[model samples]
Target: MTAKYLVTGASGKLGQSVLRHLTETYQVAPGDIIAGSRKPETLSEWVAKGIQTRVVDFDDAASMEKAFAEAGRVLIISTDALDRPGHRLIQHKAAIAAAEKAGVQHLLYTSMPEPANSPLLFAPDHEGTEAAIKASTIPAWTILRNNWYFENVFLSASSALASGHWYSAAAGGGIAHILRDDIGRAVAAALVAPTEGKTVYTLTGTKAYSHADIAALIGAAAGKKISVVEVPLEGLVQGMVGAGLPEPLARVFASVDTMIGVGGLAKVTADYKTLTGLEPQGFEAWVDSQAAAFNALVK
Candidate 1:
């Protein structure tokens, strides 16, 4: 059978979720999907279900070319190579070049929101990848600019709940954070029913929430008062470093808050609904669903 859809990074959380949506939710045949990953053996479960698995490494041109050879639509999930500085861009460019050479019909990329001007540390990689995709000879392409994930709150929220204070530099800025599963569903929908020509979709929650607003939600969910302590970007970075985080990761955390403070993630878009025909989950609802996790932090 010809592979109609190919998803790179198929073993990762977002990739697995997208694959599940394609097979279970959209009723796409497993035989029509190609699940590609660096370690093809890790995808044995998918392979068991008749989903063809291939070893596709963004850094290896031959692997990427072979992976895209039979795919009509290819999804290039961004890699987590931020620690290596320019390596992520190099890998993404190789993937795009391979897809173009394979003559794929449509190419879809998972990108961060506002990469061109965002203050996020990894924005450059996404920006460069998007540029490369646009410059390539691929006949069609779609860019999915995903907002902050709701699950990312646990990176800082758990520690904050333990201390009863959430220190943040994002004072009044609101972020329209969406769930990862919602993003996965939207991505699967895009691949299943692709649009004509070049398209860019900024997927975000229907509602935006400020730091104070998130703290309030946490307070309600955990049944305890969680204070929002506003701090300067430098102070936030220093505090994170003092709390045992490495300098580079701490800087990334602080930069995210600084971006939030400048309303970088405040855009509320309807792209999710437009693509999946479902409303994205609200922040309050997501918080309530994770009440057990939040309450555990206080205990």
Candidate 2:
């Protein structure tokens, strides 16, 4: 079956949610969707549902070509190679090249919010990928600049719940954290709808919250006292390193906090609602929903 939509990185969390939305919510035929991943065998459940599965390694130009051969629209989920600098950009360029060679008409990319100016160390990869997508021959493209995911805060929140202390460098900055599932729904909606030319959407929660505010919400939900301590950027990085995090990932965490402190993730947009016709979950509500996780952390 010829796939009308192709989703790269199909084994990842975001990819799985997007595929679910396409099949369950948007009602796209399973056979009309192709799930692409480096390890196609891991997508057996999707294949069993009549969805086509193909190997699409960004590093392998030939694999990308085969994966995109029969796809009308392709979604290039950004690769998870943040630790290795410059490697992700190379992979993204290769994907774009293969997509062009396959004559794919429409391309969609999952990018971070304000990559061009984000303080995050991995911002260059997204920024470069967006530029490559624009420079590609694909006639139509949509760029979803997704905000920080609430799921990302789990590690910190869990640690705080266990230790009763939350450390950060985001002094007064606010982050409009959106759920990964919400991003998936919005991406699925965009792919199913009729789009023309180049379009950009900033996908974020309706509201933004500071680290202290988030900690309060977590504290309330977990029925524990959690104090957020604002530290210096260097101190945060050192703390992370002391906690056994690798230097590269520790640096990423510290840089992200610094970015947040400078208002990098503070933008709240209605693009998610505009695309999906639904309001996004707020930070407080999301924290409440994940109460079990927080509770478990303390237990």
Alpha-carbon local distance difference test for all models: 0.91, 0.91
Error of 1 at 1 (Å): 5.3
Local accuracy of candidate 2 as per-residue lDDT tens digits, 107-189: 99999888887788989899999999998888999999999898988978888999989998898889999999999999999
Measured with C-alpha atoms, the lDDT of residue 260 in candidate 1 is 88
TM-score of each: 0.97, 0.98
Candidate 2 stretches with Cα past 4 Å from truth are none
Expressed as tens digits, the lDDT of each residue in 22-61 for candidate 1 is 9999999999999999998999899899999999998899
Point out the worst 10-residue segment of candidate 1 by lDDT: 190-199
Winning candidate number (TM-score): 2
List runs of model 1 lying over 4 Å from the truth: none
Go through the candidates in order and give the clash count of each.
0, 0
